[model samples]
Target: MPRPTSRWIAERASVGTSTVRRPDRTTWIVLGRAGADVAVVFLDAEDVELGRRTVGADSWATWAAEIEAGEAVRWVWNDTPRWYAELLAAGTRLARCHDLRLCHAILRDSALVRADADLRVHTDWDATPHADPPAAAPTLFELGAAPDAATGLPEFLDDAVREFARQRTAIDGSTDPGRLRLLTAAESAGALVAVELRAAGLPWDPQAHDRILRGVLGPRPAAGGTPMKLEDAGRRVRAALGDPSANLDSQPKLLRSLHRAGVLVESTSRWELAQYRHPVIEPLLEYKKLSRLLSANGWAWLDEWVHDGRFRPVYVPGGVVTGRWASSGGGALQLPRQLRGAVHADPGWCLVIADVAQLEPRVLAAMSGDRALADAARGKDLYAGIVDTGAVATRAEAKIAMLGAMYGATTGDSGRLVPRLRRTFPRAMALVDDAAREGENGGVVSTWLGRSCPAPSAGWHAAQSLASAVEASGGDETRARRWARDRGRFTRNFVVQGTAAEWALAWMADLRGRLAALDAVPDSDAAPRSGAVFSTRPHLAFFLHDEVVVHAPRERAEAAALAVREAAASAARLLFGDFPIDFPLDLRIAESAQDD
Candidate 1:
């Protein structure tokens, strides 16, 4: 009789005797770096060793591509970006992967994991990603040692096997194995999507970008000069203050100028400026706007980032504490609306743009299992539905109330409206309120999928302790209360935002697979600019927190739109099974991503 599977079995490497390819069997191939060579270890569905092969560094791409050509296999590796980016550069595509580094981070901090799990003690797996994109595809023989700090864990076959075993053991011992399993799977899939999005860049139009800049700033300035419109605005602002040569770019000088002109604003922020009636306000605002465009996403930006009609930004998945993606370079997250016209599609193709209407509140409704809130969210406008329930007088009030409830607002209109929401939607209000109280009391709160908020800092604890003393000063108590409220706000928002991020990951992962399964276009119709794997098929081009842009052939635009919707439904179902909450998307199929 076969021995029952256990951690002991998982640690052992049993090389299969079969030399011939087993196309019918599902295999897990673990890739590792051996000194001046590449180590490939294969395991079958039950993880019994299938075989081991060492391919020369020079032939690694060819070997990997051959394996990808097979029926059913999932690659397992230390980091997706490190291994997959090179294979993608070589025109190889993969179906699935188990990213050990990402999964380790998830399991280590996950609230579901048992406290005694060994994964919690593996401090080596806590390394951050390399700030730069992966090193250029190296010659297999030259890829000797893993770069220090590039990965936290060892990049050898044995270490990979042992780490994978530890991760499995943690998952099996977790309080909620099913939820952790799904979260890990979704997190791994997000790793794949991040790499692919970088490989298959968003289509860009340089001319359109140039036009927007020119229209706003009056053409690019010659070397060592500001744009014509920006210079004109600066002159008007200086003239209004009766100092023709006053420097508007310098904040102190500008503030002094405003004060001298009888504008009693404390700062140069737009909102503060709006409160004033000074002649300099409008021109100063315009100058700041144009100056930002010049500095952030101007001609120099176009020259550096955009290449071959595509804007390829490096996406760092799980970078933010709330699990939202962060960009290393290319300013992808802050893409200005003015530049949307630059995000055009290739000829004979379309951009399928979609974003959830109000992801966080909808997520809160589902996660808290507040049937009333869920019913309010059954349609397109969740805020309007809240108004129908008499939570507030108007959609705007409902929005303010909901935002206040999730973000821990204590003042202004949001604060005033929040009480009404609490009275109407007690269950939904209770979740965030509890999270906030826990944070203020030095406790950690977790998202629906078990990603926990970070622990309170020593400084925070010290402040709270000082305030508890018999002789504590008013200032001490005030400072402590302020810090506690700040932490409360952070934890309160963390659960909603983090869970929303998980939903987005599931959506993108499902959409990526659906797009890959679509029919490929003929070579003549391929957009080679998208790189190898996506050149001939519909694929994800860009993803922000709750939005996705799919570049699809015109013939498949309708199908791609349907795929996107279906993927969203699948993600919602996977996250909140039978919760009866709906995630309605504001979807559009257009030649360019320009808003109407």
Candidate 2:
């Protein structure tokens, strides 16, 4: 790659004829492919083009590092994994980014944005990130091409600039620009974190994982064979059912076997099975548990996912409609607690594990501005605080009532306890109740940061319309009411859950920066398995909704723990801004993420 000569820079500067801002004044750096070269467009705070440069693929990382080192600028790109993955492989870690694809999605459907906003128009900018197989270090040039049908997002330089402008316009013209801007930034930051998490994978101890599996399932069996303990449980269940030929793995077969034995359960679900006073129940449950372990994170899973001491699960940021992340593979989101001990730190490092307590309820308190609920949640367990408020007799009841309120549960113990909560915390209860009503009426509800719940589907409208027909049948009305209530429950939780997701993003984003700021350990003590960009520093290892695990050198473990706690506080402040609500974490600094 040839270096950009002074004459080449001057010519490019003159071609644009835009007043070049000082390096310090550059606020955004947009990157995109330009033919065989990469176009780097610098923008000012107002999104005005400050200057531009076209660098070859061979020199892209070097140029990016130079420009990044010169000033604090947020890199604007189409997709994070496509661009940032290559940079990280080249040992170039960026502080921040503006992912156009992600921001476009948030702004386009956001209830806060005007209906007629240009961003609302269907465009390729609304495309999701490509679902490509995980590569160790994908090259920028190899990933760059014209917008393909696989991922509708545009790939060239001009496309990114136009999309960025549109996003800015949408946010600027939104009803609450401040909140929308924050949401977009937080969402984009989450995109970067997602890639980093995959690149700097969670450390794993394969031997420990094998041990846990053996202890639970009793030895790895031959290919296509069941484990010893699982087979034993199946035998015991079969014996109890008096059917030696019964296939415990088949739910239909198992149900028939149970009915033949007079267990008489409609389904083989654990809850239903537990209702019977039968000898098969215990062994059946045991079989199911072992089967889940084998299927989910068993020997096969360990062999496939854990590589070179790291478990690199592909994280799909903003995958859920409510802005919660979803894993495409490797079951990162569903890591079993029993196997958490396998999440081992490096020989010279420690894991700073932290997860927020009662995140959704606390978010409800803050978003609703429910001072009474906030007071109850101030510096103590939110449920215990509710107990103190006399909302319920015990902490367990307090939790049940709060969950019932948010989830729109209207039966059983939840139904009994919910009314007490409605009276005690009217503001919080009213907020969710209002959302439920809107959802039932086919309306949309937005999170505190403006991520809107998806509108009712066409099928929903058809059902609702059928129920309201002049000659509607009783079943039609019943089904419609049930569907409406189901939607109501979904939307009731959407606001709190979505907002909680935003808070988690803010927490992780803040924590990402803080961890980056910590001093790097000596090379001899570095955790090279965390990848080249993160080996020497305290980098985020794993993130699951409200929890985060940071792999840090022993020397920086305390600092990383402090960063985790401080980030939670920062996230709460960023979202609620002095709402007097707290997000306390259950934090532990240890060598392995083993449950106590």
Best by lDDT: 2
Candidate 1, TM-score vs. the true structure? 0.91
User: Highest TM-score: which candidate?
Assistant: 2
| Stretches of candidate 1 exceeding 4 Å from the true structure | 1-26, 44-48, 134-155, 260-266
Q: Candidate 2 lDDT, tens digit per residue, 1-596? A: 55433223334433353554443343677777665466666676666675666677898888777756655678898778778887888888888899888888888888999899886774766665654434534333334666534333235565677788988888888899999989988999998898899899999999999999999999889999989999899899889989999988788887888888999888888788888898989998998999999999999999999999999998999999999999987989999999999999999899999999899999999999999999998888999999998889999899888999999989989999999988999999999999999999999999998999889999999999999999999999999999999999999999999999999999999999999999998899888888889999998999999899999999999999999999999999999887799999999999999988
Which residue pairs overlap in candidate 1's backbone?
A: 57-140, 57-141
Off by over 4 Å in 2: 1-17, 20-26, 131-155
The worst-scoring run of ten residues by lDDT in candidate 1 lies at 4-13
What C-alpha lDDT do the candidate models reach, one value each?
0.84, 0.86
RMSD of each: 4.9, 4.1
Give the Cα error of residue 251 in candidate 1, in Å.
Answer: 3.7
